[model samples]
Target: MTTSTQIDTERTDILEMLAKHRHFLRLTVRDLTDEQAGLRTTVSELCLGGLIKHVAAVESNWAGFIVNGPEEAPDFSSMTEEQIAQWGDAFKMLPGETLAGVLAEYEQVAARTDELVRTLPDLSVSQPLPEAPWFEPGGRWTARRTLMHIMTETAQHSGHADIIRESLDGAKSMG
Candidate 1:
């Protein structure tokens, strides 16, 4: 096979896997009300709506790293108490937040991530990791690695979401 053909195949495979995982995640929240989506079904704090929001944020942030280097860390010193609290609950849907709104935002983030995967000059492009306790200091990752990471996160959360969905209403994403 030609190099171009191989590259295209690899990209298609990655996109397909990502989409499959995302579909499972979305299916978990299907037909769920706002209250249902926000219900903590398991002992953990994770909820369907919160998982969707968190995944969208994670993908958006990592996609940005493909085009731009690590972003400046938020200045917490100037943050108000409420703002700090909000940051802590970034994954959870706050009052007045709706399931539909979070889902729509997630769709937008997914579209943007698809575009980035399709149009990037090269998947080999690398960027330094952001400053986070979970991330290794001075670590760098290629665009391909970043996409794989997103896929992994989505797939893992899809399983969690599925379990939560089952607990919420005896509904499951798959048999």
Candidate 2:
């Protein structure tokens, strides 16, 4: 909804759903310092800052896919331990990374995505899935489907962030 163009109800719904989940995910980190944001509270390695970072990165990549189709995907099925570790780093707040920094990145990513949703000429435009073990080969996803994927991913990670926050200090994002 950035321009004079009238968005349909579906686009508005996508934008609203995205905004709602992103709120909860970000709220999970409210009042946390960088150190606390990076602290892993569960057996899982997920941290609050990392969740925000991951969500932003996911949104950015998928938005790029909507625009330009899939880029070269890493060979996850045959990754070296070091490569695997680097991939794992996506779920971490590395040294010198700050909660504020990640949040800023998330905002920029989200704005771009919202604009894409608002301005994309056709939500039915589809992109072929990148070849990967996990993805069904030859599968294609429409822009609308891709946006739903982004929303679902954000919702899933928001739940993770809520758990991390609860474990950190008994804070509940929705309660």
Q: After superposition, how far is residue 95 of candidate 1 from its true place, in Å?
A: 1.8
- TM-score of every model versus the real structure: 0.89, 0.91
Where does candidate 1 have its weakest 10-residue lDDT segment? 70-79
lDDT score at residue 68, model 1, on the 0-100 scale? 85
Which residue pairs collide, candidate 1? none
Q: How many clashing residue pairs are found in candidate 2?
A: 0
- Write one digit per residue (lDDT tens) for candidate 1, span 103-171: 999999999999888888788999988777777989999999999999999999999999999999899
Best by TM-score: 2
* Least well predicted 10-residue stretch by lDDT in candidate 2: 1-10
**Which residue runs does candidate 1 get wrong by more than 4 Å?**
72-84
For candidate 2, report its TM-score. Answer: 0.91
lDDT of 2 at 116: 98
Candidate 2 stretches with Cα past 4 Å from truth are 1-7, 72-81
